[model samples]
Every structure is written in structure tokens, then in C-alpha cells.
Target: MSSFDLRLLLDPPRYPANRYAPLADRIKRLLATHANVVFVQAEAILALEAVAISIARPGRVAVNVVTSPYGAWFGTWLSRGGAGVHQVSAAPGQPIDAAAVSACLERLPQVDIIAAVHAESSNGALNPLAELAALARSRDALFVVDAVASVGGHPIDFDQHGIDIAVIGAQKALAGPAGVSGVAVSARAWAHIAASPDVAPSSLSLMDLKRNWLERGRLALPGMPPPLEFWALEAALDRVEAEGIEHVIARHRQAARASRAGLRALGIEPWIARDEAASALVTSAPVPTGVDAHTLIADAARMGVELAPGYGEIEGRLVRLDHTGTRAKFDAVLANVTAYGTALERQRVDVDIGAAARAVNDVYAAR
Candidate 1:
């Protein structure tokens, strides 16, 4: 490799401590929280695991809300840490209902922790966060939300909702690098983590991060930080601030509305039928009769459009389309919808591609 390439990849200096604080502060601003924020030098799953490790232990009762596989993983992580976990699971490809969560809290008043995913991209479903958070508060339980996919696309008021721990990633609506993540911990959540004897000094320990935050401050990171990811996150935040967070959210909403309408016009209704239950970032639609999801996806790809299939068990049954961050634009929406409609036409499925494209443009123009 050339010297320039080597210098760019390996010779970069360690990031300054002052540089670190601004990133964390920007992330805190994005979360709309005054809670303690810690930037983890790994993917979001690690930060999420740290939250689970900090709270799960014997005698602690946790209610895990399962809308998708990520929720199931949270319950498993808590269980492995010896917490008594009761999972409130929704039907496959469906968002968890607030009623189900309320019932769980009512039946198990001893529940001290409530965990849920705010929006699941895998199934394109959005859980009732404010309702669930209210229930958690009424039950005096600490509410933990995985807002990885919802952060920029949806409005999240961590303090208003009484969410004790909110974990977010850069790869989704933020349109940033995936190598780093952050978590906002409320005072109550920190207290629990600080008091928990099960909380260790491992990489997945929130208490350790807390200690690092206190001693090193924002200028200094705990360990060797991924400078590249940190810089990427900072750039992404700059773009978000430039566009205004609320406008970004509105764009995402419009994208979701247009995408769903276009898909319906192409004879494929979104999987999350209800508007309230659908996620702004992702829209999953059922595979039409006599057409496999893989075939449909391949057809779209041949038209220069890439589409994601349903995750895990739901694979082959649904086609997943994303409209988050940079993708939440008129051109991107029009392109994806046109590609899908064209693909269906290739399969001899009748669809008005022009009309579908017009629908997307109309929504963009309306807003």
C-alpha cells in the first residue's frame, strides 16, 4: 500500500479527550436526556448487553417485551444473569401491545425491571413506548428501551417517558458507522447498577463504564477507542443537527407513509397494517401470492434495487424496505418503489409503476 494509505489507516493519532466529550454530549442531545451517557467502543449489542449485565441478578424480577428476536435475546441475557425473567411476547411480525405489558406488570407486581424494543426493524413494528413506560412507572419498575432503530425516525423523550436506560446505535436512523454505540442511564438506573453485586468489571459492565466516565471525564475514554467510528458518529450528528432532528423525523414519517402507499398500489400491503404499529424506518410487506420473497428480492436487485428479506423465522414471507436517515427522501423513495413495481411487472404481476412513483413524489411534495 502507498504511504498515504498506510497513514490514513494506521498512523492516525489517538483521539483527544476533549474530542470525546462533545460526541457524548451530542449523543445526549440526540437522546433528549440529561442522563449519564457513555459511548461504548463496540457495536450496539455490547452496550445493550452491558445494561442487561448491570441489572440482572437473583431476586430481581424483569419483564421482557418480545416483538422480535432482539427482545428474546434480552430476556435470555437477563435469565443467564440469574434474573427471574417473564417475557411478554407478541405474535410473530407484530408489535407488542401496551395491554399485554400492563397485564404482565399487574400480574407480577414484584417486577423491578421492564425491557422493550421501541421499534423493531426486522418486522417493521413499533411498540407503544409511552404507554409501556407509563405502566412501568406506575409499577415502580425501571424501564429499559432499545431505541437503536427509532432514534432519529421517531420522537423519543427519555426523561418524559421515565425510561431509565435507553440504548441506541449509529447504524440505523443516524446513518453512521455501526462499530460504536451509546447508552443513556438515568440516575435511578445508575444507582441500581452501582448497587448491584452481580455487576462486574468486565467489558459488558455498565458500572465499569460509570467509573471510567467519572475518573476520565469526556475528554478521556476508558480504553482504546475506535477513532474512526467516533469521528463518523460526530459527522453524522453534524448532518442531523443541520437538518434539525424534528425535520428528520418528519421526513422519515413521510417516507413511511409514501412507501406503504406505493407498496399497496403495487398490490402488496405492509405487514404492520396499523399506522400506529408501523415503524418509520422500516416497512415490511407480505410476499404476494405465488411469489417467493427471495424471488421478489432478486427481481428488485436485477432492477438495481436492493431489498432486505424478513429476518429469521419471518424470512421468505415478507419483504423489508428501509426508509431512514438519508434514505428518507423523495428520490430514494421513488427509486425503491419504482424498482419494486418494475420487478412485479417482470413477474407478470400487474402494477402501475408510474402511479406508485407519483404517490411517493406526491407525499414528498405535500410535506
Candidate 2:
């Protein structure tokens, strides 16, 4: 490679001190909160683990919700930290039911913390965040939400929902790099972390991150941070600001409607039956009989359209059509439905490509 290329890729300018505070401030603004914001130098999983480590201590009762794999991992993390975790699980390919959560909270009224995923992209289901948050409030528990797949695509008011800790990833609905992530922590959460004797001052400690922000005040990070990813996140936030957040959310919702309508027109059923419970970030559809989800994904890719198979155990049973960030567009919806229809036809399945395309167009037109 040329020297210019090497320097451009390897020696990007360092993040300026003045921009650090603004970056954190912008994230707080995006979440529509005055809560403390800490930008993690790693993926959102690390930020969430930090929250778990800070909150889960011996003798604490935490209700860990398991609607997706991430929730399951959080439950395991809490258990490893000596917290008594009561996992409330939803049926496969379904969002967590408010009634079940209410029952769990009622049974464990002494719970100190509640952890849940706002949207399960794996199954394209949106959990009842408002109801769950209300339950946490009733129990006086710290509400922790994994908003990785919901932010930017769905409406979120951290303070309004009484969310003590919310972890977000730039890679999903934010349309940014996976290398950077963040968390918004409420005063109640900070207090919980400060009181935890087991909470250590480490790289993965949320307390350490909060200290860095308070002590450093508008200065750049203590160590060398990833300039590229930070700048990319800034650019992504700029885009969001340019197109109004509400409009961005509406676009995502519209894309999901178009994708679902198109799929239904092709005789494919959505994994989530209720529109209100489905995630706008992604639309999951079951693979038709005699057809492998992987094969369909491969066929779609060959036609210049990429589709993701359902995560983990659900793989090969369903296909996920992404509608988050840049993918939440009319063009993307059309391309995805057309690809699915064409792939079905290639497999000797009777699919009306014209009808599916028209359905998608109709949805967009209605929007």
C-alpha cells in the first residue's frame, strides 16, 4: 500500500480534548436525558457487563429477563456475581409478556434490580418496556435496559421510564461503528454502584468510567482512545440530528410495515404476530416448508441482497430482514422483498413477485 494510504488508515488524528465532553453530551441529548453518559471504548456487551458487575452483589435480588440471548447472558453474568437472579422468560419468538413480568415482580418484591432487553432483534420482538418499567418503579428497583437494538429506531425516554442504566451500541440503529458503545446512568444507579463493596475500580467498572468523566471534566480520555470510531459515532449522531429523531423512528416503522406486508403477500408469516409487539429494527419471517433459511439467504445474497438468519437455536428456522438505520428505507424494503420472492421462485415455490412488490409499494405510498 502507498505511504499516503498507510498514514490515512493507521495514523488518524487524535481525538481533541474539547470534543470529549461534547461527544458525551451529544449522547445524553440523543437519549433525551440529563443522566450521566459514559462512552465505552468497546462494544455494548462490555458496557452492559460493567453494569452487571456494578449492580449484582451477594444478597441482592435481581430479576433478569430472558427474551433474547443477550438477556440470558446478562442473567448468567448476574448469577456469576453472586446475585440471586430470577429469570423471567418469554415464549420462543415472542416478546416478554407484561403480565408474566408483573407476576415475577410481585413474587420478588424485594428485588434490587431489573434487567431486560428493550427489543429482541433475534426474533424481531419488542418487549413491553413501559409496563416493565412501571413494575420496577412499584418495587423500587433499579431498572436496567439493554437498548442496543432499540435506540434511534424506537422512542426511548430513559428518565421518563425511570431506567437506572441503559446500554446502547452504535452498530445497530445508530448506524455507527461496533467498536464504540455507551451507557446512560441515573443517579440511583450511581448510588447503587458506589455502595457495592464488590465493585472494583477497573477498566470494566462503571464506577471507574464515572470517575474519569467527573475528574477529567471536558478533557480527552485519560488514555489513547480510538479516534476513528469516536469520530464515526460523531458523524452518525450528526446524521440523526440532520434528519430529526422522530422522522428517523417513523422511517424505521414504515420499513418494518413494508417488509411485513410484502412477506405476507408472498405467503410468508411473520415470526411476531402482533404489530405492536414486533421490533421495528428487524422483521423476522419463518422459512417456508421444504426451504432452508440459509439457502434462501445465500440465494438472496447472490442477487445482491443480504439477509440474516435467526440467531442461535432459531437459526435455519427464520430469516431476519433488517430495517435499522440506513436499511430503514423504501429502497431497502423493496430490494429485500423482491429478493425473497425471487429466491422462493428459484426453489420451485409459487411466489407472486409482482404482488409482493406491489404490497411493499402500497405500504410506502401510505407512509
Candidate 3:
């Protein structure tokens, strides 16, 4: 396909395979390309619900390694699903190390499933899944990962990393709408789900969805799928495939590097510690002295640049810089930095505008 026609692939159209056949097929293709992987599309929270149900047993425990708000929420979901939830805590801006997880499991012998976030978009921390997955494997526990903000923008090797179940969302890195997200399930995860006697909501049940849509060769129930979002996701996936996942990941890494360099040049330190920093997306420096993060973001918006404020408690204290999806470009990076510099200047925060731009330029030039 030519560059011009790339956009055409994103167009939504009903196909004979099923109402949501195109999306299901796309996800299946992604999973089938990787050994021992199964793909299910649902909100990340819903996916976690399934994972909780799939893995929960009468006496087994599910351990959630919390490094972000999402992890805490998932832990609650696991607990509500009848699994004993063990929270292994890590400070914000840092990741839960594999050794820490291993220690937790060692202390809690009943732990059967290990859940963690691959990238905590809330704090811009990237967990070391490969290492953690190995640790989980050593303990013979199912490794469940939340890759919501990492999948399209970072490197994730389900088979190589030994991740039994990895959840992804559309809005963050895929550059798609929020309603559609997906989860990749390993054979082990499927087995866990299959063995469970707990009844699942028909639409929310991973096993039911798999049976109807995948094994039984039936379309999803009417009014049960997000057609446009699915098409958009397929389009996004096609773009990723064309560009190559490695190249996509490298681009995000480069953009993140440029963002950090620019921020540092402007005398801004990232909220996240250097060791656990994520390349998929960036969280802003803590609110500068005498300046509010909300004001900075508002100023950027006035300058025609959109930036997200930190969610929950961090709101107005930090900003989030997303370098993913269709907007992952050097020009986009330059524009964002320029807008930020402008905003800071307006707020009377000490900022060397030229230097920040130059720092980003240097990274782009080197690339």
C-alpha cells in the first residue's frame, strides 16, 4: 500500500464475517502472529475484571504490585472478584522491582496470579515486565500485565516476557477513542478462565466471547460492539504493522528523550525518578514554585496546544505529555515544547525559551 492509501485502511465498513469481524480478526491476527497469545477487546478495567475472575480460586491469592492509581484500582477489582488481594507497594514515580515482587510471593505462598503495570502513565514509570515475569514464572504464578499506555508506543514481547495476560487501551498509544481496548491472553490465562466455575456477564466474559466469536464462528451479539472504534483500532494496528513495532517504539523513545531534554533545559525536573522513567509518555515536573500546573496547561491550550493535567491527587500539580498515536512526530514535539515555554514565560516562571527549543531541535537533528 502507498502512503496516501494508508488512511483508507482505517475506514469502517461492515464485513460478512461478523458485525465486529474486522476488529476481532485484526486482534486475532496480532495474537496469532505471536506464539501462545490470545486477544480480547474490552476496556482495560473490564479486562482486569476478567483476569481476576479467570485466576481466582477458592484458596489462591492474586497479588497486585501497585505503583500507580490504576494498579490500586485493579487490586480492588481482584479483591472483589473473590481472590485474596495482596498489594505490593512501590512509591509513585518508581516501579515495583522483580525482587520486591518475588519477596511478596515468597511471604505469601498462596499467591497464584501476579499483576503489574508495564507503564504507569499516571507517573511515567515503566515496570520491568521481562524481569518480573521471570520472577512470576519461578513462583509458578500467572503473570498479568497492564500495558494500557505501553503497547503501541513501547516494546512488549508477550511470549518472550512470559506475560500470561496483558491489557491494552485505545486512547493512550493507539491514538484511538476510549471505548475500545484489548487484552492479550496466554494459554495459561485461558486455562485459568476455563477452569473457573464463576459465571460471568455474557458480554464481559472472556471465555464466552472466545467461545462465541472465536470457536463457535458466531458474530458478537447485536449492539454489543463499538464499530467505529474497532475500525479505528484496526487502522491504528495497520499503521503500526506498516511502520514496524520496533520503529514505532524507537520513535516514542526518541520523542520522550527530546521531551525530557527540553524540560530539563527549561529547568524542569520530571516528577518520575530517572531510574523508573518511561519512554512511552511523560509526566511533568512537579508544579514549579509560584506556578500551578493547571495554569500552565490552560496557557498552553490558549496557545492552541492541548496538554493533559495529572489525574486525581496530582491534578494541578503536574501535567502529562503524551508522545503516542498519530501525533508522535518531531514537529509535534517541537510545537509542544514551544507552547510549554511560552506558557511558562507568561506565568513569569524562569525559562530560557530558545534553549528549550534548541534542545528539542538537537534531538530531532541527531535523529
Candidate 4:
């Protein structure tokens, strides 16, 4: 038998039930939001769905931006909640154009809510958040953002941006457990959510979280909370504070910058060519023709670098270099680029691996 007890992994630490509210507050501060914060026991997607179901009603009109599967699923949730949906879809894994959204809004429909993703990790696309917010404000509509991928990598001044409902997850840039997530809801959003006659009554209900948790002194959650996830989340918050949030964000940006530079030196093009439209969370590029992405990424993993393929519809078509939380460092960035270049070499692709390594080194040295 191994010296370490196996049971320890199952019961490492116990998270205090009462501290869940305080943990939620910590996430609120991370978001820089003044909105009412609700901690959900499930992952971010459920929190997103609850937000949509809460705001959607039969008479409501929503302009939903579809850039990836996550945004598409959000629109489905709104539709299921009886909202009249006007979808502004882009090419798969592409950011929605602000002009397209405005043109859609000008079609004489009174939009009650505007739903979009802040950044899409699937193809490293960063949506036009400010422009989308401005369009929503012009129509006097509630702006809902799924910031699952952008929270720590990008600055989110939630209240300052007038975001009515912003959904966040800990797994992406926060480097926390995937099981626990939170949402920030503004007063205007509450008014709309409270008006929904069919607001979810069970766990996927934001209104209940507000009434049962937020208004009731922010103690324990209504349902049984996941203790391990809460404990891990607390640790993540502590780590962020220790590292300084600004430094953490800067690291992700630096990693992205280096990865992009290295990719260019190797003759690989970023999927989102425009730096302005790409997210710092991950650097993505189309998979080289005839190269199996899974095999390439798996090969990279053997070299001590973690690489991922695109999600859903874009799977196998793109390869991504993640720079999330702890991995957003010069070493990680260099290793990622080097491993990919080497993996490509193994596939008989002529790549300038030496130049790519130099490019990554130059970026960090200059910084």
C-alpha cells in the first residue's frame, strides 16, 4: 500500500458553511461590481442560464450575440424562458461585430435585454464589450455578459460599464474549482428578473439566491453547498490577492504577447489576427492542414506543456496555447511555443523553431 492515505484526497479540508457568503463577496470585489452577488453551487454555465431565465419573459425582446457554443446555448435558455430572441450570429468562433448588433437593434424591435460573451476561449476571440454596452444603453436595455473566460485576464469594471447581469466562473483565469461560480445582478436586472412569473424555483434560480442568500444576511446557501469547491475557491481568491490582481492580469497579457510573437516567427497565424479582438486567456491558431490537433497537442503534453484543441464545432480545426492564472508566465509561454514547434517538426512540417524561441525570449527580455 502507498504511504499516503487515499481517503485524504476525499476529505482534505472542510469549508465552513457560513463563509460561503464572504467568499461570494470576495469574487464581487474581484469583478469590481456593485451589483448584488449570488454564489451558485453549480458551474458558470448554470449561473448563466439562471440569469437568462430570470430576465426572460414572454413579452421581453432579447438581442443575443452568437459567436460560440456558449453564446448559442445562452440564447437557447432565453428562448426556453419565452423571450422573443433576435440573434446576431457571426462565422463560427468569430467575434460579433458591433455594427451588426446596432443594425439588428435598429430593426424597430424594442430590445429588453442584450446578451453576449465578453471573450470566447474556443478561438481566442474577444468580443467588443464596450461597443455592445453602448448599444444596450442606447436602447435602454439590460446588458448581460458571460465573462467566464475574461474575468482575471481582462479588466471588468462591471458597475462602471452598466452591466445588468454578469456571470463569472472560477475555472478559467481564476484557476479555481469548476463546480462553483457566481453572478452579479444590478437593481435594474433584479426588477426584470423579479417580474418573471416562471423564475426557476430550484437550484438554477437567481431570484431565490437573492431572496434566500443575499437578502437573508448572506449566510449559508439555500441548498447543500459543495464544500470542497468553496474551499478551493477561497484559496484561489487568496492567491490572487497575494500575487496582486494587476500583476496576474499583466502576466496573462505578457504570455499572450509572447505566444503571438513566437507563432508569427514560426509562420503560424493567430486565429483572431486582430490583436484587439483576441483574448489574453489563450492564443489560438488554425491547425496546420493534415495535422491531427489532438495528436499534436498530446505530443506537446509529453514535452511538459499543456495545449488544447478548439471546442464544439471548431474542434480539431484549431490549436490553443493556454495562459491561464498560474501558467501565465515566461517559462510557460516559452515552453508552450517550443513544444508546439517541435511537435510540428515531428509531423514533417518545416518550421523555424529556433526563430520562434528567440521571439519569445525577446518579448520577455524587453519587458
Better of 2 and 3 by TM-score: 2
Q: Show the colliding residue pairs in model 3.
A: none
Better of 1 and 4 by lDDT: 4
Tens digits of lDDT, candidate 2, 111-216: 8998999988788989988999999998999999999989988988998888989999988888988988989999989899888754545767887777776566
Cα lDDT of all candidates, in order?
Answer: 0.86, 0.86, 0.72, 0.87
Q: Write the per-residue lDDT of candidate 4 for residues 1-367, one digit (tens) a residue.
A: 7899877659656577688767777878888876778888888888888888788889899999998999989999999989999999987777889999999999946899999999887778899999999999999999999999898889888977889989999898888889988888899988888888655477767888888878888877787777788888898989888987788888888899999999999988888888888899899877899898988988998998878888878898888898887788888888888899999889988889999999999999997
Error of 1 at 220 (Å): 1.4
Cα-based RMSD of candidate 1: 2.3
Model 1 segments more than 4 A misplaced: 1-10
| RMSD after CA superposition, every candidate | 2.3, 2.1, 4.4, 1.9
Lowest lDDT sum, 10 consecutive residues, model 2, at 1-10
lDDT of 3: 0.72
Candidates 2 and 3 compared by lDDT, better number: 2
> Candidate 4 — which residues are off by over 4 angstroms?
1-6, 12-14
The Cα RMSD of model 4 versus the native structure comes to 1.9
